[model samples]
Target: MTRQRYRQLRYPLIALALILGLLAIHQYRLYASPVTAQRVQTVTISNAGFLPNKLSVNKGETVSLMIVNTDIRPHNLVIRELNVQSSDLKPNQSATLQFLAEQEGQFPFISNTPGYPEIGYQGTLIVN
Candidate 1:
């Protein structure tokens, strides 16, 4: 509560935020290529394609999809039927989508980006 103490605390908080931002940027650059780094215990979308087209997960398992737009053009990883999708992804950008596979059976996914014909940009989630 003194003015000087408050100022000192603010400086440390700002410094911590800056350091975290820098670390995140560095990590984004490192894993932006392959999309999934060694530390990512989940799936990755590499080269405009889902690394594992068919994912077999158990029901109620927590699944994380680390999707990166490695393609030059913008794209999206969408599972419309499942009502799960990510915002548009620009090249060299990455986003993590975490969901619980609570149901069993096949779930299809595709690139919901417009103007691009649907190619191999599709995948399935096979929950057991």
Candidate 2:
């Protein structure tokens, strides 16, 4: 090729090579990143207390707990160990608590709503 023609193509060739390099790096990152397991569990709150009062998950997994209030009062869920809490949910209302189960142990969750008995409005989260 003539010198003039080579000069005209040089910039575009470099740009194409840079773009391909960037794309290759992006694909490598997507492949090298770890994939975490996601879990969604639904818990219903009623006069009888938390339905399925026990939850279990594996370590390093993401958990999404959907809490639905089906009783005649408002309530909230708290897991101090995991630093997870949900907004007060009125009767027929619902809330979702999301967190990573990084620790492997049994954690207790409870509703701190006034006038509610802690004994009945509590549950255990078992992380393995």
Candidate 3:
């Protein structure tokens, strides 16, 4: 190859190598960084029922579930695994509950409001 053509090719190859090396270093840094799994999720309650009866989150993450009672009657949200329980959510009222998803499994929730068995309140939280 001509001297000028070889020089031009060599410069481009060197630039490509540098770019690839930088990308690899960046990726390594990202992987080596501390990974703390934390997340927040919102849930709404309406006249019909819970907007999302089932929620999915990553293990070791904390979730903040916002419950907005849009119904006339009171309702409650209970998660046994997280030991979280709330009651007396009157109509147009809102409440917030926090819990950490340390277990990797499915947990159930219920309203626990009396005379609401027929209406039935049930949900699940899945962690993985």
The candidate that achieves the highest lDDT relative to the unseen native structure = 2
Q: Give the per-residue lDDT of model 1 (tens digit) for 14-107.
A: 9999999999999988888532222333445566487777777777776677787777777878876667887788887888876767688898
Ten consecutive residues with minimal summed lDDT in candidate 2?
33-42
Model 1 poorest 10 in a row by lDDT: 34-43
Candidate with better TM-score, 1 vs 3? 3
Query: Which segments of model 1 are wrong by more than 4 Å?
Result: 1-48, 115-117
* Native-to-model Cα distance after best TM-score fit, residue 47 in candidate 3, in Å: 2.4
Please tell me which model should have the higher lDDT, number 1 or number 2: 2
User: What TM-score would you give candidate 2 relative to the actual structure?
Assistant: 0.70
Question: Candidate 3, residues 23-86: lDDT per residue as tens digits?
Answer: 9999999999755435456667777677798999888776778888887888878886679887
Tell me how far the alpha carbon of residue 96 in candidate 3 is from the true structure, in angstroms, after superposition: 0.8
CA lDDT for candidate 2: 0.88
Off by over 4 Å in 3: 1-39, 115-118
lDDT per residue as tens, model 2, 19-118: 9999999999999976644757999989888888999998888888999999998988888899998888999999888788899999998988884546
What lDDT does the true structure give each of the candidates? 0.75, 0.88, 0.78
Question: Which residue pairs come into collision in candidate 3?
Answer: none
